[model samples]
Target chain A: MAYLELNNVHKTYIEGEEEILSNINLSIEEGEFVAIVGFTGSGKTTLVNLINGLLEPTRGEVLFKGEPVKGTSHERGVIFQNYSLLPWLTVEQNVLMAVKEAFPKKSKKELTEMVAEYVEMVSLSHAINKRPKELSGGMRQRVAVARALAMKPEMIIMDEPLGALDALTRGNLQDEILNIWGKDKRTALLITNDVDEGIYMADRIIPLRPGPRATLGPEFKIDIERPRDKTEMNDNENYKQTRNAIIEYLMDIGNERKSEAQEELVLPDLAPKDFVNQFK
Target chain B: MKQSVSLNTAGKIARFNIFRFLFQGSIAKVKQMDPKVALKKVAISIASILLFLGLWHMGAKALYNKEADFKINKALEERGQAAADSEAACIASGNPDCQPNTLPSPAQVWASFNSLLKDHGIISADKAAFKEKTAALNAQREAENLDPIVYTGRPSFVDQIWRSLGTVFAGFLLAFFIAVPLGIFIGLSPNLKSAFNWFIQVFKPVSPVVWYLLVFMIVKTVLIGSPDDSSFTISFVSVGLCSMWATLVNTAMGVSSVDNDYINVAKVLKLGTFQKIFKVILPSSLPLIFTGLKITLSVGWMVLIAIELLAQSPGLGTFVWEEFQNGANDSNAKIIVAMFVIGIIGFLLDRIMLAIQNSVSFVKTDAI
Candidate 1:
C-alpha cells in the first residue's frame, strides 16, 4: 500500500452543487517529497485538508498507511498557508504547544529543548520570545514551519506556506525545509503556485488543474540530483525541458478555460422605438 | 575605585533631579526636555481647569445675586424700606439664615469639602471613645452570647464613600460571575444564543429603579424571619441586574466573533473543548470581555447611588440624599462637593479598568 493514498475522491461543499475537487486519485510512498503545483483558487488547500483529515471527501476515500483517514492527528502535521500561530503566544510557546501535544510523555525540559531545536533549525532563535504580531510575515511563516516540524509528525503537509513571503525569503525557506526533510526522508507534500519552488524542492511535481472540479494532472519526475543548485538550474537541459512543458500545459488549460467561459449569449432581436431612436 | 565613586555621585544626582522634577518644578529639567510636548500638555491641562473653575465661580455669583435681589424685593413688598435695608444688611453680613441658598461658589464648595473631612475625623474619634467606654460592658455581653454595645451615630462622608465602593465592587463581581459563563455558553452555539436572545433583549433596558423594586420585594420576603438587614443585599443585587447587560452582550459578541482562523488552528491541534476555550477562545476574546467589564463597572457606579438612596443604605447616594433633604446653611455646597467626588471616582474606575484591559490584551484597547 502507498504511504498516503487518495482513491477517486470527490469533494463538494453543498449537495447537488458543482464539486470543488472531482475524481482525484494520487499516492505518495514513504520517504517521498511530492509537490502539487496549481493556480490560485485551484482547490489545492481542499486536497491538503482532505489528506490531513480536516475534511472528508464527498465520495471515495483517503487512506494513510492503508487505514482510512479520520479527524486530525498529530501524525500528519499541516503548515497552513496563513501561518496560523496563536497571536497571544510567543514563537517558542507556539511551537511548544504543538510539541507538548504531539509528545505528551516527554518531560517539560525535553519539550522545551525540542521546540528550541526546531526554532533554531528555522533560524528564528533570536525571535523565540516575540509574539506573532511582533514578527514580520516571513518570520511568522518560519515560526509556523518550526511549530509543524517540532511536532515530529510522520508526514508534513504544507499548503502554500511560502506564498506570502518575498522571493529571497521563499528561497531560504525552501532550502531549510528541504534540508530538514533530507535528514529523515519523511513523507512530505508541498502545495505551491511557484513552479520553480516545486521543481527545486519536490521529487515528483504534479499539477492541479484549475477548478470548478479540479483534479490532478500527470506527474513530472525531476531527474535532477539531490542538493540542486539554483544558479546552475537555468543552464541545465532537463530543467529547461520540464519547465517549458509545465508552463505550456498550464497556459493551454488557462486559455481553454477562458474560451469555455466565453459562450455566446443569444440576444432577442428587438427594434428601438421611434422616440428612443431620435437621439441616437 | 574612581569609577565606582563617580557612579555613586551620578546616582545621587539622578535622585536629586527626580526630587526637583516632582517638587521644585526645576527650569533646568524643563530645558532638558527634548520633545517639550509633555510640558505643553501639562500647561494646557492647568489652563483648562483654571478656565472651568473661573466659569463656575462667575455662574455661582450671578445666581447668588439674583436670589439676593429677589429676597430683598420680597422684604420691601411685605414691610417697608427699612425691612428691605435690613435684608440687604443681612445678606452683606453673610448671615447664614438670610443668604441665598442657590449654587455654591468654588470657595464655598472647598470649605464644605474641608468641613466634611473634619466631620469624618470627629465621627471617628466619637466612635473610638464610645468603644473604649463600652469595652468592659461589651466583654460581659459577649460572655452572655448577646450582641455587644454599638455606636448608632450616622456614618461620615468618608465612610459613605467606602460603603459605596464596597457595594459597587460587590455588584461588579456579581455581574461578572453571572454574565461571563452564561455568555460563553450562549456564544458557543447559535441555538443557545437565539434561545436566550428574547430574554436578554427584554431585561437589558429595564431601569435600576424597577430592578430595585423587584429585588426589594424578593429580599424583604426572603429575609423576613432573619434579624440581619437586607438593604445591602437588595441594593447590590439591583445594581448587578441593572449593569450586567452590557457585559453579557459584549462577552457573547466577543466569543461568537472569534476569528475563524484561530478556531481552525484549535481544531487542527485537536485540542479538547475545554482546552480550546481556555487556550484559544478565551484569550482571543479577552479584549472584548474587558470592554464589557469596563462598561459594566461604570454603569454599576452610576446606578449605585440611586439604588442606595432608594434602599436607605448608608452609602454616598444616601449621604447626598440626606444632605439635600437637610437643607442646612452648607447643604448646597456639600451637594456640590459630592458631585465632584462622584465624577472623580467614576473617572478613576474607568482608568483602572482600561489599565487592566491593556495589560491582559494582545492589542492595545482604547477606552470607548
Candidate 2:
C-alpha cells in the first residue's frame, strides 16, 4: 500500500454557489517529497488542507498508515504560508509549545532538551530568546520550521512556506529544509506556485489546473538524486527536460483558459451556425 | 631582583600607554559635549513664565485698581464718622493711599490662609469630629427653615484622599466582577453577541446620570422600600452599573478580535477548550482588556461624583456642592481647594492603572 493515499478527493466551498476542487487523486510513498503547483486561485491550499485534516473533503478519503484520516492531529504537522507563530510568544516558546503539546508526558527537562535540540538544528539557538516580532520575516519562518520539526510528526505539510521570503533567503531555507528532511525521511507534501521550487524540492510535481471546477491535470516525476545541487542540476539533461515539460503543460492550460474567456466574449452574440463555422 | 626590575619596566610602559589613551579620549569627549540644548530649554521656560505673569499683572492692575479707587473714596468718607473708635483710628492713621482694598495679592491670600488655620479652627481641630459636626449641622439646617453654615473646620487632606480612593477601588472591583466574564462569553459566541448586542448598543450611549437615576429608583422601590435609605446603596449601585459598560464592550471586542489563525493553530495542536482559552485566547486579548479597564475606571470616577451630587451622598462631590451653596464670602476658596483635591486624586488613579498596565503587558520588539 502507498504510505499516504488520497483517493478521488473532492472539495466544494460554496461561498454562494461555486465548486473549488472537483477530483484529486494522489499516492505518495513513505519518503517521497511531493509538490502540488498551481495558480493562486487553484485548489492547492484546499487539497493540502484536506490532507492535513484542517478541512474535510466533501467526498473520498485520505488514508495514512492504512487508516482513514479523521480530524486535525499532531500526527500531521503543518507550516503555513504566513509563518503563523504566535506573535506573543518567543521563538523558543513557540517551538516549546508544540513540543509540550505533542509530548505531554515528557519531563520538563526532556521537553527543554528537545526544543533546544531542534532550535539548534535550525541554527536559531541565538534567536531563541527573541519574540516573533523581534525576528525578521525570514527568521520568523525559520522559527516556524523549527516548531514544525520539534513536533516530530509522521508527515509535514507545507503550504507556500517560503513564499513570503526574499529570493536568497528562500533558497537558503530550502537547503536547510532539505538537509533536515534528509536526516530523517518523512512523507512530505508542499503546495507552491513556483515551478522551479516544485522541481527542486519535490520528488513529484503535480500541476493543478484552475477553473470553476478544477482538478489535477498532470504529474511529473523528479528522478533527481538525493542532496541535489541546484548549480550542478542546471547542467543535467533530465532536469531541463522535466522542468520544460511541467512549464509547457502549465502554459497550455493557461492558453486554454484564455481562449475559453475570449470565446465567451465573442460567441455570445453569434448564431449557432456562425459559431460552428468560426470553430472550424 | 633583576627579573623584578624587568617586570616593573614592562608594567610602567603599559600604564603610560593607558594614561595616554585616557587623556586623549577625555579631551575629545569634552569638546563634543554641547550645553546649547540645556541653555535653550531654560531660556524658553523663563520667557514663557515672564510673559504669563506680565499679562496677569496688566489685567489685575486695570480691573482691580478701578475698584480700589471706589473703595478708597468710600473709606475716606467713613473715616470722619469712625474717628472716635480705636480700631477705626488705627485704620485712619495708617497709609490709606498705599493699601488696595479690592483685590488681594498672592501674598495676602497666603497670610489670610495662615490666620484662618490658626484662629478660625479651620485646620487645628480633630478632623473626624469636624466632619461629623459639619454633617450634623447641614442636616439640621435642611430640617429647619435656616441657611446652612460654611464649613469653618478643615478635614485632613490625606484622610479624605484615602477615603475617596477606597470608594473608587470598591466600586471598580464590583464592576469588574460583573463585567469581564460576561463580556468574554458574549464576545466568543455569535449567538450571545447577537442577543446582547442590541442591549449593549442602547445602554452604552445612555448618560451615567440616567443609569444612576434608574439605580436609585430601583433601590428605593425594590431593595430598600424606605424613603430614608442609606446613601451607600444608591452610590454603590450607581457607580457599579455606570462603570461596568466599558469593560463589557472592551472585553467582548478583545475576545472576538483574536486572530483566526491562532484559533486554527490551537485546533491543529489539538488543544483542549480550557487550554485554548487560558493559553491562547486570554493572552492575545490582554491589550484590549487592560485598555477597557483603564477607560472604565476613569468613567467610574466621573459617574461617582455625579451620583454623589444627586443622591446627597457624603463624598468630595457633596463637599463641593455644599460649599457652593454656603453663600459665604470665602466660599470660592473652599471650592478651589476641593477642585485641586479632585484633580490630584483622579490623576493618581490613572497613574496607578497605567503602572499596572505596563507591568503585565506583552512587549513585542520591532525585529519580527
lDDT of 1 by residue, A14-105 (tens): 99999999999999999999999999999999999999988999999999999999989888988999999999999988998888778889
Model 2, B1-368: lDDT tens digits are: 99999999999999886554434433444456676865676689899978866775576566656765555566667774453254344435645443444433333344444543454354545544666778888788889978776554444434444555666677788889888899899988999999999999988888878987888777777765465545766776778788888899999999999998898788888888888887788888888887788888988887777777787766766766776787454444555555656776676576666556655667421110
Top-TM-score candidate index:
1
Q: Could you tell me the lDDT of residue B362 within candidate 2?
A: 77
Most lDDT-accurate candidate: 1
Clashes of 1: 0
Tens digits of lDDT, candidate 1, B1-368: 99999999999999886554333323444566765776796799899999999999999999999999999999999998999999999999998999998999999999999999999999999999999999999999999999998999988999999999999999999999999999999989999999999999999999999999999999999899998889999999999989999999999999999998788788777888998899899999998898899899999999998999999988999989999999999999999999999998998788777767766788875543
Clashing pairs in 1: none
**lDDT of model 1 at residue B5?**
100
